[model samples]
Target: MLQAGMHAFILALGLILPLGVQNLFVFNQGAAQHRFRQALPAVITASICDTILIGLAVLGVSVFLLKIVWIKTIFLLAGVCFLLYMGYVMWKSKPAVSEDEERIFSPKKQIVFAMSVSLLNPHAIMDTVGVIGTSSMLYSDMEKYVFTAVCMVVSWIWFTALAIIGKITGMADKSGRLLGMLNKLSAFVMWGMAILMLLSLR
Candidate 1:
């Protein structure tokens, strides 16, 4: 069980360490919020989405996804669309400076964007479904559950830490110029991801 847990932790960390639309959005929310707690919706939503994906992966749902090419294509297309829209939103967004309350993400917007980036992202889905799911097959029964739980726990911890880090950075950037640059960079990342997905469809 300990071995399974450790394996899952390492694998989950590897999968999540890369920069992506989901990670950027969560970090951006952390930086944009007036308080750390205000960023909870994004972190919580993302963690929940990842938990669900990991759970399904362990249950062999990825096998179902692989056997259905059309379903995968549909998911990818929707993901690309959302990523593009998100990029536009990010490009136009201003930091949540005291004078620009309108720039901040409300709880509802946080939930929606968090869900879109997490659930609609085919790259993330495939990593969870292909890498984590395939890795989980190495275990059985109680060990399998332990592996799944560990992966979920790691994801939760990761998002929480990421937000905390972002909050720290936000606090430091009193002028908001750094955050402005970050927003533009995030837009590029989102658009790049979308283009990659579109190209893959070829």
Candidate 2:
């Protein structure tokens, strides 16, 4: 159970750290408003997908994923690099004080964009489905449920806070300093996570 929990947490961190890079950039570009508004539908969709993958893991899908050694390694490495690059982007990014706010705030576009980003992203699939689901298989059904519940709660808290903050603070205007800091912090987190994952691979 302890091992399963650790695996789930690590996998979640691995997946989320990279995803955060892309999201934060969009956030800095003032797309956060769009993202926040569309977050509800996007998050809901992601949750359902994650739940299904986790269920499959409980049914022994993880073993299949684990066997694809090269694929897992490739994804793991790619996820790490993507995060580091995103961090770099954030570090160099300035706040979006654009004059075209009205043009970019379409609800349907936002929701569709959110869905596409979260759903089609290979890194996300690997983390939630391959890593977390695979790890969850180490434990019994009860423990797997507990682990999944914890991970979902984590996802909910993160996305909710991000959307709310983006809406309230207006990432376009007053979030430059805050966004800069977040980018740096996210970069460090990603670098650390990547290193840890590499170590585990060896």
Candidate 3:
């Protein structure tokens, strides 16, 4: 159980360390919101979505989904379009002078976007299905439970930490220049990821 837990933790940490769309969205919300509490909805929504994906992957549902080529293709195309749209929106966004001026997404909006980024993003789905799901094949029964639990825990902790980091940075940047720069970088990163996804589709 210990070994399985450790393996799950390490694997999840490695997979999540990348600056992906979901992480970027969470970080951006943390930085844009007036208070850390205001970003909780996004943080919680993203973590829950990941938990669901991880659970589905461990159960082999993702594997079945992958067996259908058209489903994968459709998901990939949708993910690319969503990423490109998000990038364009981020690129055009203006820096807010203060928290009050920042465009805060309602809880429903945050949930929708978070769900889309987690469930609709083909890369995220593949990572869960391919990496976490594959790794779970090495464990069984209680060990498998431990592995899944550890992975889910790691995800929750990592996202919380990410939001905290963003909040701290937001607090420090009174002039919002840093936030503006981050938004631009996020836009480029999203576009780059979309392009990579497109290339993979070819």
Candidate 4:
């Protein structure tokens, strides 16, 4: 269980650390809101969206993949290819630099926008379903449960932390150095994960 939890933690963190629409939205909200608590709507909405996606990926995707051996091989190979491609994309990606919106958003707008960014984004969905869901195949019974739980916990904690960081950093990475480093680090982690997953096929 401990190992499963740790694997889930690192994987989840690696996937989320990159700068994306979801991260930027939450970060901007945190910076725009007057107080930490004021950003709860965006934080909570994004967390809830992630929870739903992870649950579906683990429960729906993992179970189906488990039943088919041939498909499992194909899925594993495809996942490896994807992680490599994603790593390259991350390595070349430039972080978006945007000024915070001029007006304060009400909780309702925040919820709506959060839902849009969280659910409407294809890449985010792919990370949850393609990476996290397929990876959950490594364990069974209790370990799987721990893996799922840890993934969800990471999402909640990460969203909250992003908001806090946004408040402190004021949302814009003028130099892009911080986000550039994050992209590089995330790419390496993805590459390493790809290697580990490929080894499992042996």
Model 2 Cα lDDT, one tens digit per residue, 3-106? 65666666665566554533543343333344465445544544455555555555666557656989778766765665555445445544444554553434
lDDT of 4 by residue, 165-201 (tens): 9777644556656666665765776677677667867
lDDT of 4 at 48: 98
Query: What TM value does model 1 have?
Result: 0.97
TM match of model 2 to true structure: 0.52
Model 4 ranges with Cα > 4 A deviation: 61-102, 171-202
* Cα lDDT listed for each candidate: 0.92, 0.55, 0.87, 0.76
The CA lDDT at 77 in model 3 is: 90
Runs in model 1 deviating more than 4 A are none
Worst 10 residues of 2 by lDDT: 25-34
- The order of the candidates by lDDT, greatest first, is 1, 3, 4, 2
Q: What is residue 202's positional error in candidate 1, in angstroms?
A: 1.3
TM-score of each model, in listed order: 0.97, 0.52, 0.94, 0.65
Clashing pairs in 2: none
How far residue 129's Cα lies from its native spot in candidate 2, in Å, is 3.2
Q: RMSD in angstroms, all models? A: 1.1, 6.7, 1.4, 8.8
The ten-residue window of minimal lDDT in model 4 covers: 94-103
